[model samples]
Target: MDIHYRNEPPQFDGANLQMHFIAEVDGEPLDCAITAEALEDHFGAQSALEGPLREAFQRGQTLIRAVCTRAIEQGAGPVVLHSGRFRSPDVPDVLH
Candidate 1:
């Protein structure tokens, strides 16, 4: 239920944006997610304004990984992490 930021002042440019989350249970890494965001805001929002969103994503990933890892680590079974793009169900078909 705790989150940690491995990097501060995360790069805004698509080239340097790297985000990672480590899920740990009983102090052991179980699952993790690594992702990068390449889009930019046109509203000229300050960097500080984006921290919460980035952090939240990272934290959520971490927690998910932790839960999955914990289950496997405790001899429940293996853990698999899947990665893919997400789209809103309401989006127009043209975008697909």
Candidate 2:
């Protein structure tokens, strides 16, 4: 099963930044239990989440986080942060 994440920007409440996201399994959204981490804004993009959809975004973030955390923890092997390996079409993994 493949899970995809759709994010709706970060919601800043003057003091905190709330990241809202959705988890879709096979293109369908599923309600999930999640954990939240307050990250430092190294990029300095201080835009806040507002309007009628703000509350919904916040809830979505929680759901997505929970789903991801649970799934990753259940997987085997060590959890490593930032391998820094990104797929670049311009640069092939193997040189011909």
Candidate 3:
């Protein structure tokens, strides 16, 4: 899985921050977008959602939470986060 911050030079004018998360498993790709504020709520303002991301990383699930957390801390302002699963061949049947 790869986490990247989109919209070069994240804006911090109180606007929503956008992040892109890409997950690949067995050559299949899963992409998702999420925001900063949502990340802040989930992982606090000083830390990333590494736990959730790790969970996804281990379970082969498409995770965007960590990417969003970084985007927000990098200056992406208050954000409205959104996420979903994409095409993934190695995703486990049940996510722990």
Q: Specify the highest-TM-score model's number.
A: 3
Model 3: per-residue Cα lDDT over 2-65, one tens digit each: 4333322222323334434543323444344444443444323333344443333233312344
* lDDT tens digits, residue span 1-96, model 2: 666556545433433334433456667664332112222121122233344234433544443344354454465112211112112232233411
Task: Please provide, for model 1 over 1-96, each residue's C-alpha lDDT reduced to its tens digit, 9 standing for 90 to 100.
Answer: 432334333333234343334444455554343233211121122342346436544444434344444444456433332222223343234324
Which candidate leads in lDDT?
A: 3
Candidate 2 vs candidate 3: the TM-score winner is 3
Cα-based lDDT for every prediction: 0.36, 0.36, 0.37
Residue-level error in angstroms, candidate 3, position 84: 12
Off by over 4 Å in 2: 10-17, 31-37, 41-96
Model 2 lDDT at residue 51: 40
Model 1's lDDT to the true fold?
A: 0.36
Off by over 4 Å in 3: 1-16, 46-96
Candidate 3's error at 15, in angstroms? 7.4
